[model samples]
Target: MKKLYFVHLLNDYSGSPRVLNQTITALRQQGNDCTLFVGSSGHGVLDELDVATHTFTYKRFDNRWLTLLAYVWSQVALFFALVWRVRPEAVVLVNTMLPFGAALAARLRGAKVVYHVHETSIRPAALKSFLRRVIACCASKVIYVSKYLQVQEGIAGVPAVTVYNGLSEAFQRQAMATAYQPVRKGRFNVLMLASLKAYKGVNEFVALAAALAEDPLLKFTLVLNASQREVDEYFASRSVPCNLEIYPASSNVASFYGDASLVLNLSHVDGWIETFGLTILEAMSFGIPTIVPPVGGPIELVCDGVEGYQIDALNHELLVRTVVRLSKDSQLCQALSERARAKASEFSTANFQKKIVMVFDEL
Candidate 1:
């Protein structure tokens, strides 16, 4: 059996790691020998899987300079360790552009390197350029999560393919079982799941909630991918509206989806373009209509006036109007819900598995 090394910088309960976990499961089911090299930062979805694991010290910091220093140090250490660890003819799969050390080591050790590109909005323009240059020089093949990302970041000569992210079978099964029930009556819940960052539109969501606070029945929920302490610190100076509720990071979001009348991804396009909205897809699986950013990967998933509406996160007036319209119009919401579920079926776990395996095999 051929050896495959999967390297990811952080193993948090985030989109990239979750996608990597699903990919590893698929590859292992096909009888491939898979080994994972991840950071010892926090517990993650990858922990559920039983596999051979190697961890390196890495952690996020509150100070920007400290964080940058730690990240560069981790890469330097990872380069030497990966050079010694990876054997000839083995395939190295780097989860994101941040972990360029794996690609360098793979190229130096005479192994093939494949990158699964997930995000395009990395801070510090020079760092982003450096990582792109690494991909150009070292990667043998590239996999982009969305066509929008491929168009935005595709290298001139590097081979690439676009694979839409998929919902895990377990998540699909749960959504299918829960969505068949009657929609909750009385209160209307507008939900947004994202990291606790300004670019992610946490401020916009809070503003929307404040704008619609006059209607007591309309509620807003924000599930952030951060700890409770982090959430508290982020909101220390800001006043939270009564209708809006905030929650820390969680793996189980089925209950939120089940209770939601509408889902929203309010990413600020200028600051951060959402390459693909995983939370929007999860909402679709639950037969809930979504409001996502007008640009980037979300447009491919949702059609305006169909599965959901695509509106700019900065447009507060339009967002308020849309929320009021969806809250009052029950029939329209039901119609969109059915279409949303159907659109979600096109990007299934089975399809993701088949496409990913084909990419690896061809490489």
Candidate 2:
């Protein structure tokens, strides 16, 4: 087995980190020596992983680009030192420009660089230009989570492969704890599961809630992973209906999915569209029918009128109509819920691990 080093922008438990930890586990099982170098402090979630890790002293993911630029500059020497000492056979860089600094350091040491691309949207033309160079020149190989993301990036003639981000075994166990069953009694639950980002259509969801405020039979819940202050700042001016609730993000989200009748993924096209919406499958595994915008990697995951509904976010009428239909019809809800669980199983961790191992073999 080759000695491998993994680099990620954050140690936090989001899409990139979740996929990174799982990749580490799969690599370890094959008897490969591995190490992880995270760009910033994790939200203590990295402690659960068994891999060896070193994190940089850094700034929060925010508007202040200088905070990130300064942190990257500070870690250049340290990252170079680590690469020289370990001399890994391959260094896998995960997500965005966050790990570009370390990738450079690894390349300097003559190690093969593998970049895993989770983001499809790049801003400020200059950043996109730099990414193009990095993919073609620095990386010996590039990995994409979904073909949709690969196509969205619109970069050609690069050594790249697509592997769907898999759901964790821990999550599979949690999914098992609650059977794939839905009871459509009482207030019909409609959940929007996302962090409070403008591109996530936070404002759109609020408008949806208000438009359907008179529907006493339905309730809307925003399951977000932002600080209360941030959440308040975003929604303070909006009028939340009596049936609407804002639930803080938590580790124990499986229970919330269990209680949910329908889930919504309304990420805007202006920002990063879902490059394999991991949460979409998470909800499906619990037999929760979801509503997603007709864009991005989520289109690959959901088949409209089958497993779940996919509507254009700009068309608010369809969003309201679909939700109303699913809530009133218990049979439709159960049918979709059952089919969703089946669809979710196809993208299981075992399937993802096999694809990832194949990529490593090629590398």
Candidate 3:
């Protein structure tokens, strides 16, 4: 196995950083020397992970132009100071925009580069296009987390491969441990695990809760990364329903799945194109059927009415009816949950590792 260095964009606990952490662990386990370099840290996703990580001076700024300038300046300074010092055979830039500097650093040192793209920026099309072109020009191989994202980026004439994100071992174990149990004929707890971002449909979730508030048999809980007090204040400011509760995001959400009769990932297309629905996959891994939107990658994960329901963002009636049926019918929920568990086998850590290693080998 060839040794490699990685230039990661951020240190947050999003899907991209989680994938990066796993990639380095897998590479190191396969006897390849690996190192990860990040611009800054915040959410502490990479802090506990066992990997060789180093920091650089590329701090993100509130001003968009200042952010770009700082990124460029840090790239040049680190190109000689850090990347050159490491002198690995390859440099893996963890995301597209950050590749502006990492790619040049790799090119100057004559090191192979793999641009791992996890972004699907619809706004600022010009910026996305320029980054795509530059990444295509510099990268030896481009890895996209989903085919939808690959199509969205439009990085034509570049060597690329699509590797769908897979579940961690602990998540898979959660699925394996899930046993179909009969629900009592009473109120059901439906959960929505997502960030408190507009693109993620938190507002839509609140709206849905309000719409379904008349149906007193269903309770909605939103698991997100915010304090209960802040969430309560936000709810107080809005027309939040009495049937809804918002909780902070947790590493251990298997208990949330345990409490939920149905899970949701209702990202709106106009606001956000979900590259891959990590929450939906995690829900499926727990044998909990997902109620996903028909917009982006989540549609690719579930077979409507088989594994889960895919309702359009505009179809309020359909979404409401699906919710009512799932809440009332335990048999249907159990059937879909079983099918979801079966579908999750397609995205396993072992399989993902094999594909990742194959891509590195080919590169």
Candidate 4:
């Protein structure tokens, strides 16, 4: 069996780390030796995985110059450490910038390097273009999470593949259970679970809520992972129409999905149509219909009017009208819920792991 080393700078419970954890667990279950190289925040998720993990004392710096220098030093040190110790056949660099220092180091040691692109790099226009060209040319393989991202980068005629993010089997089971519950008495509950960032369209969701406030049938819950200060500032500036509650990030996310009638996502600028809309998928798994803007990852998951309807734009009037129509149509809601669950099953862990193992075998 080939030994694979995965590297990441942080170990937070975000999309990238979650995907890494799923990949490592899946790889180990198939009898491959996998090692995860992580920074200080390593102990939480990685400790539970079947694979081995190595933690380094790489401090995260906020100062621009110091951060760049420290990251370079850490990569160089880590590369040599891996070569002298684990000596893996291949290295998978999760998310890093510049010359993709980890990949370059692995190449020097005659080990194949794979670069997993999770987000668009931040650099001056000329430098960013140059970096993309170099990465496209030198890396042994490139894995993109979404087709929308691939097209945006214009990565043509290269050793590239699209592997979507997958949910765990447990999450799938939870979704199924959520879908089977009988409807309870209450106003229609709409949920928007996203970081309260500008680009994520939290403001648009609020606007939509305001437009529908006079309607006695609608209510909203805005779940955000932001500092209390930031959350207060956001609420102070905006006026919402319906009964609104701002919740801090909580572990009981599935419970929230279980209680909601619909999930809404309206991102303005997404990297790759969202390789996968995890929130929407989870909501669907629970048998709740979703509403999303007509762009990016949601379009791929939600079959407009079948699984859920897509808003033409973020206009408050349009959003209000759509919500009113769905709230009034019980048959449409049930049909959409059924279709959403079916769509979610296609990305189940079984299918995801099967495809991921195939990729490893080809390598």
The global C-alpha lDDT for each of the candidates, from Candidate 1 onward, is 0.90, 0.76, 0.75, 0.70
Report the Cα lDDT for residue 149, model 4.
Answer: 60
Order of candidate numbers by TM-score, starting with the best: 1, 2, 3, 4
For model 3, the superposed segments whose C-alpha errors exceed 4 Å read 58-81, 86-88, 96-99, 180-186, 226-236
State which candidate has the highest lDDT. Answer: 1
* Predicted structure 1: lDDT: 0.90
Model 3, 71-176: lDDT tens digits are 6677776566554654546555555456466676777677777887776663367766666676767788888888887787746678888998887787688767
Q: What is the C-alpha RMSD of each candidate to the true structure, in Å?
A: 1.2, 2.3, 2.8, 3.6
Clash counts per candidate, in order, are 0, 0, 1, 3
- For TM-score, candidate 2 versus 3, the one ahead is 2
Name the lDDT of candidate 2.
0.76
Writing each residue's lDDT as its tens digit, candidate 2 over 11-61 gives 654667678778888878888878777765446355567777777665664
Candidate 2 displacement at residue 136 in angstroms: 1.5
Q: Candidate 2, which segments miss by more than 4 Å at Cα?
A: 71-78, 86-88, 180-185
RMSD to native, candidate 2: 2.3
**Angstrom error at residue 130, model 3:** 2.4
- Residue-level lDDT of model 4, residues 99-184, one tens digit each, is 25556557667777666776563544665676577576657667776676666664565577777767888877787776533234
TM-score of each: 0.98, 0.92, 0.89, 0.83
Instruction: Note the residue pairs that clash in candidate 2.
Output: none
